[model samples]
Target: MTKEMDVTEKIIELLHELEHCTDSEQKQKIEEMNEIVDGMDEEEFESFFTLKLFNKTDKMIEEEKISMESVFLLLKSVGQHKVLMHSQSYAFHSSSLNKRFEQMIIEEEKKKEERNEKLLIDLCECTVLLSNEISSELLSIIVTCLLKVALKKDENEETQKEVEIALLALSYIEICKSVKQEWYLNEIKEIIKYHQEHHNLTHLAYQSAWQFLMNRFHFNKSLDEVIENELHFSRDATKELEALIKCVDWKRGKGEEKRKKKNKEELFLFRWLQTLGIFFFHWRLRNEECVGLISSVVQVFRASKDDNREISDKCIFCMGCAAENRVVENEDLLKIGAVDLILEEMQGPTLDNYFLERHMKCLFEDFRRLKNAEDYKNEEVKRKATKRKVFDKMEEEGFEDCIIGLCHYICLGEFRYFSLFENYPEYFVYL
Candidate 1:
């Protein structure tokens, strides 16, 4: 046989021997297994570990040759073999192995044994290593179990650890784009509602909700039903606005000294904003609510301008969407100084070219509409003044200046490529 075939045969032999060996003898055999694994090249190593080891475990579970607890222990023991753990071979079987382990956890949860719960928690923690391999169906199962553990009432230190690990796992699983199971959505809603009511889990709960929304938006699923039906964004506008503002305010700390720790909170907050912008772009709101939302988002954009360009860009896009909603008029935007805020933000070095183009297009359209409205008003004034022998052109002059100013901003530098100016030379010359 070739060297590779020989190695494979040897590994299979060792695996069978280790399975039959007593617990004490198994330790020495595991050490020998590790030694054998360490000697193989990358491809052979992955093949032996994933295909051989994983398949053996599957057989052991199916045959009742080993308890789930014992199998978990065996996996843990082999995981200590650094070569196996880090190899692409391990990654090859990680999803299947994780799916099996998660299934075991779900089964164990029905028993509600503290030991089993602890094992489940440990297994959940270990799954992070293989998170990228987790499939959508497996992710749904994992999230369902983790949410149960997170919501468990046990307040002991160990239980608290379990809850923390479960939350972490939920966070990782929450971002899976392919997870479209409605059962998962229902559980996530429960977690959000429970945490929103209970002060202790509020932050973790919101984090989970944020991730779920992001995943939903990524898959192009509609969130309007969820927001309107479950979240009650319209019924509880003030409370929801406050919560959103709190999320927006979670900024990364300034300075190199304070930057050692990750800004995960801020990162999650931006993700929440992005999810909202994508899925709820045209959500209707009252005038007062619109003002609050617009103001808070603008502040977030300004704060993120220098530190996080992506967040700033997303904020601008979301705000532009909000502006388009019929509930938020240009007059309301002007009253709140939104136009000035947008203008200032646009001038910043961090503004992206695409978003800047979008911003200018919006402004050009709004100004052009306003100019037309003023022309109609001026025509009425002219007709009345001609009959009454009076004249007035002041408002028309001011309107023309406003249109010219907007055109100037639009035509500046690279923005001159805007199709509006190209399509209508009359508007440009009137400037």
Candidate 2:
């Protein structure tokens, strides 16, 4: 017999022995199989996975000759082998085998059978490792099955692991093809809603799923084409942005609460806002949609100040980016209460030079744009009235003095406003 044939037979034999092997022996047998697969040349690796392994596993599963544990171990061992994964045959083998594996998952889901978590994870890992090489059709099937597992709502350790792997897989999927379909876009929307609404999804799973959708729409090339085609994602993005803004309870407490560190949920909310901030910075939405997004970001900036400096810093940064991006409308500035928030932040007791300067620059830019946008001939009266209101508010809030004090530091070429404020008793707030 040929050497390749000999290796294939030995692999199949080990898989059979793995079925009934003791837990103690299973690891040894799996290692032995890994050693063989790891040693195969490109052609042998391709032939073994494409021609030998799938047929053996299919028959073994059909005859109940393999335990789920054994099947998963075998599949994981073979699928993760360096030689096989790097082989030219990877695309064909991954697509065909993933399709077959997806069918079994579908059947199990239909029967409501409790699946092995390792099996699902291994299945997902092997497929995702295919990267952009795997067929979009096969990816859709796998993603559909995994989402079904996640939405099953079993609410246990098993469900958490399932959802975690599912989200991890989603994060790795290349957006080249699947995102073009309407149904796939709807699925993305549904998953976003589910993450925001459901408390059962653990932080890891929640973050994974959010990071996936965030990256897909925020950074992927597919999103460029989607936007170029005028596909509607702004509404969904805006809704989620609104939910993120409203979810934080910044008024929950003060003095004593200030001593306590942020809880996991609070931390996740603030961090995800940072992620969304990056998304909004790059995403181009219509003027009306930009209106809602900027409004929400300003709300977070206003309320994130109670006790959490980190949250406050993040929200402040987001607001600055929103303003810098010109998403903040001059007419809507006062209506959205951003101007008031800025003045409040400038006058507030706690002062970080960087954040204070950011708020100042945003307000300055807004005022600058407001002045430039007024039509000198026709809107002269309206411009004077609006300018009077803004200047009057600035004077009432001592914002002019704040600006003068800030300018003093600027003129001195000093970047450390806190130290400058320390010597000026009027500007200093001693903790």
Candidate 3:
């Protein structure tokens, strides 16, 4: 341990002396320091990793010898130093990595907007690569830093574009650690203050900002305030909010193309919608008018069924609740085809239809709540166009009897509602 301590002191001395040392001395000392840092001295683990010397920081900005362009190589070589980076004594300045980044960006802010895009791309890649190892406190340090740069209040067109990309990329951090609390409304509210000064970021900032608010706020704010702000939002913000509201309102199995594309994105976005949905349903949007949002969720669950089983099942179960909501509110999601899509996905073998066989009672039982048969007997509801629409689109592709059975179902009344008796006798078809 003494030997390691002596060796580290020597390295620090060599680093400081590099300014005055001759070429030979500098080269030899640098190599010697590298060897010691990388050496297998057991007690040197914290020393080697921390690299904090004479109250200096490990963040490259503090090291005058290293330039911004070389930060990547330095971080890659020196790596993270928990003791040095997080130690209160040798901490990064309030600006930290972000300050240095903005300094570099300021030189190019007016010249080109996309210039800093590569840095954002790199930050996202590194975040994904290191999410597991780095402390959240340290990660939040990075996040706060990036937010400052990408969200610069006086940003011009070029900077706004770069910040937008940065917003999209930074969202990859999936875990919140014990050491760090999630940055919520305050972070967003701070960004909103920037909008009046530089409106170009209104659209891009709003995408992530509204998403953040949706995840964080939901019904916590007054419903009238939420809706009024939504209705009068900076046009771009309104679009994003509507998209979010649509998602929160998802029922069970609504959209086709979207549900089918449920990739890694579906895993998180649907979860966001689910959590936010619960918040609103339980808090602000209690009236029946708000029951319409389930259509979006149903579509997501139906589409993303292949990505996650547990989440999909939960979504299907949610559909039962939404159905109940519709009944209680005298809102007919089925009339708008929310129920019909669920029924179609339910009858099929998609993984998202977990509640299909299980929750039939809950779904159909909503019917008992209707005051009169006419509530469920609208011409379009009785017509049931989804089945016919599918058959017609597939007709040219050649499913003669399938089309016939569909047509028969369309024309037949309560006496012969299904096809088993008529179409299957000539030829049996198994689902």
Highest-TM-score candidate: 1
Regions of model 1 farther than 4 Å from truth: 1-130, 153-168, 171-182, 217-225, 233-265, 282-290, 324-327, 349-355, 361-431
Which regions of candidate 3 fall more than 4 Å away from where they truly are? Answer: 1-146, 153-158, 169-187, 190-205, 217-284, 287-292, 296-330, 349-431
- What are the TM-scores, per candidate, against the unseen true structure? 0.53, 0.52, 0.39
* C-alpha local distance difference test of each model: 0.53, 0.59, 0.43
Which digits, one per residue and each the tens of the lDDT, describe model 2 over residues 1-431? Answer: 25656777787778778668776687788778878876665456655766456666667667776655665666545544421233345452444455666566455444545765545555665566433354654655566655555564557887776666666556545534444444355665565566556666765455555555555565454554443234333444455556655666665666462344334446556645655565656654335655665676666666667656666676666666666666555556677777778887888777766777667656655565555644345776766666666776777898866766666666675665444333343221210
- Residue pairs clashing in model 1 are 46-89
- Between prediction 2 and prediction 3, the one with superior TM-score is 2
Residue-level lDDT of model 3, residues 129-240, one tens digit each, is 2222333434544555456655565557767755654454343333233212244334555565556345657443444444444433333444334432432222332234
* Distance from true location, Cα of 248 in model 2, Å: 4.5
Better of 1 and 3 by lDDT: 1
The TM-score, computed over Cα atoms with residue i paired to residue i, of candidate 2 is 0.52
lDDT of 3 at 43: 50
Which clashing pairs does model 2 show? none
